[model samples]
Target: MSRHILPPKAGHPDVICAAVGWDRPLQTYYAQVCFRTDDEPDEGEALIWRGTEPGELPTPEAAIAVITPYAEIPPRLAEQLLADMTATIGEKDGRHQAEVKRRLFGSIH
Candidate 1:
């Protein structure tokens, strides 16, 4: 399982944090948006949305699509999250590893 903890954004003060990642064993992507509790800011976190259904989100992109509406993160941050999630999966897939290397080093003639 690969998890990324998104930094808190100023625009969304009530949002404590957002977690997005992939579960290798389940072969599913998941996301969780957490909010600060009303009574206690530091006490605990409230889950506003969660996408953990097996087979629901087959790809990291699909998970991001479902999470976008709720998370409300900046475009750059969202892109970074997607890249991070994909990298996690790439580590497990040989094809993806080669693709990553190509992107990083270009085609070696």
Candidate 2:
């Protein structure tokens, strides 16, 4: 799926980046953001954010990823998706964080 990672602008149509997110088994969604740096031929590997929502990730450094179906997503759908994902994947327990991180990093970005 093609996802647009938009700049944090209230009313901007053009997008500067793109992203892709997938649901993991450990009750988390890993999102990847990719963009062209310096607006040249060189492209850099962007950040991968593990979050459930937009406001849930208030900090930009923490990852404000814009993934598919989320470019124009609403708060209600985001909550529902997160709930369903959590219900399916269960909880975020230890002994799995490392595995999850490894898997997410490998698959995302």
What is candidate 2's CA lDDT for residue 15? 32
- Supply every candidate's count of residue pairs whose N, Cα or C atoms clash at under 3 angstroms: 0, 0
Tell how far residue 73 is off in model 1, in angstroms. 5.5
Per-residue CA lDDT of candidate 1, range 1-109, in tens?
7777665655777777777776653456777777778676864374644444445566667666655655655556557645655665544435764575467546311
Provide TM-scores for the models.
0.56, 0.33
lDDT of 1 at 3: 75
Model 1 misplacement above 4 A: 69-109
Rate residue 78 of model 1 by lDDT.
51
lDDT of 2 at 11: 36
Best by TM-score: 1
Task: Give the alpha-carbon lDDT of every model.
Answer: 0.61, 0.41
Output the number of the lDDT-best candidate.
1
Candidate 2 residue 2 Cα shift, in angstroms, is 13
